[model samples]
Target: MTMKFPFQIIDLTHPISPDSPSWDLDCGFTHSNFIDYEDCTSEIKFRVQQIHSPLGIGTHMDAPAHCIPGAASITDLDLHRNYLLTQSVLINVSHQTDENYQITKQDILDFEARYGRLKKNVFVLFYTGWEKHWPNPEKYRNNLVFPSISAHVAQLLLERNIAGIGIDTLSPDTADSGYPVHQLLLQAGKYIIENVANAHSLPPIGAWTLTLPWKIINATESPVQLIGLVR
Candidate 1:
């Protein structure tokens, strides 16, 4: 018997199906088939193919080169410096206000107050309860104008110099497309994790972060295996 705590695995990757909505208009996007092998299956050779979204689709990681110039790609990353990060903090900001639906410095401060000084090199994940309405595309993408880190907040992350920053939404910046926040973080070599799922399942603190991006050679970005290991 494998002894473990009551663990919940949140599939950060979006469902890759025909019914699955996608913003393909933004870029050339496609979710291919995801295969699962069952050793004791009765079906023929014991192989099943599951179709899923693309590398950047669903729960995925973003390389620094995404929004910055002359930055490193996913393939050129330092795994020791990136994956299986220590001191993971899940900021459950689900009960956020809607004035601007923006994650201000005050919010971060409040989190710091309760959590006792967010240490450096830890993965900072912002849980906004955004994935709940993923079944509804419009609401998930437009209706829920959830809190996002400001350009100034990006500077703070740089100041903290954390290993990586992640979010449950499609992006860390607002839908404005071209923003200074993304620019600053990318330029300063800040790694971003996006399209996170089921973050609410995580504890407020003490869980481990394991976000993995594919090493597509000379690629700007790739899909990631976003896993969180906790006690």
Candidate 2:
């Protein structure tokens, strides 16, 4: 099948690998060849590899079930309806934030003042300049002091009923905060994308996001292929 489009597709997902920063170090990514070429002695030769990765490795999507028991999991999501070409609004707070920075509702308001009011169901991405530490396990993790979204911002976004939120860090919540943002957003049934890459290249409001995740049954989270289509 041949398809075409007049848009620039930017890959927003970090390449997952054994060295890719994992939120949980114990669950780092690994892969091995199940059927190697050296094992094939017959005319038919093929090699099969198996990968082992935690749902939170690299760029990933968190289903509501991630924090809320009985909430929708990866398999229950309507990919086309919820993620297909969804409008993306980037809230660049990099200039004003540091590792311990917490994004607030005022930041969203500041963004709106510049990019115009965000519409419902648009995927909101935060460019925290954290991607600079990506692929560096120690730095990316940074003792979990990375920038995060405040509960107030989460509540405000919930009120707007945005499609979801994405960030260039390990999580939306600060480590010491006990996942307050995660609990609030997930319980509200909104999905979240974490460890997003190349977020700095996106416009404030003219890009659309296409999020595709591994459809793991009963899984609360899955690694995802996040892409941006510029308008």
Cα distance off (Å), candidate 1, residue 12: 3.7
Instruction: Tell me the tens digit of each residue's lDDT in model 2 across 165-215.
Output: 999999999778989889988898889999999999999878899999888
Work out how many backbone clashes candidate 1 has: 7
- For each candidate, C-alpha RMSD in Å? 4.6, 1.8
What digit string (tens of lDDT, one per residue) describes model 1 on residues 1-231? 998666554555565444443344332344443444545456665454543345566566677787666788887777776544556788877787452466777777788899867777778889887777678766566643555778777777778777777787767777663566668876777678777776776777887776666778766667677777666
Off by over 4 Å in 2: 1-4
- Checking candidate 2 for backbone clashes, the offending pairs are none
Q: Report the number of clashing residue pairs per model.
A: 7, 0
C-alpha lDDT of candidate 1 relative to the true structure: 0.68
Off by over 4 Å in 1: 1-11, 18-54, 97-100, 143-146
TM-score, prediction 2: 0.95
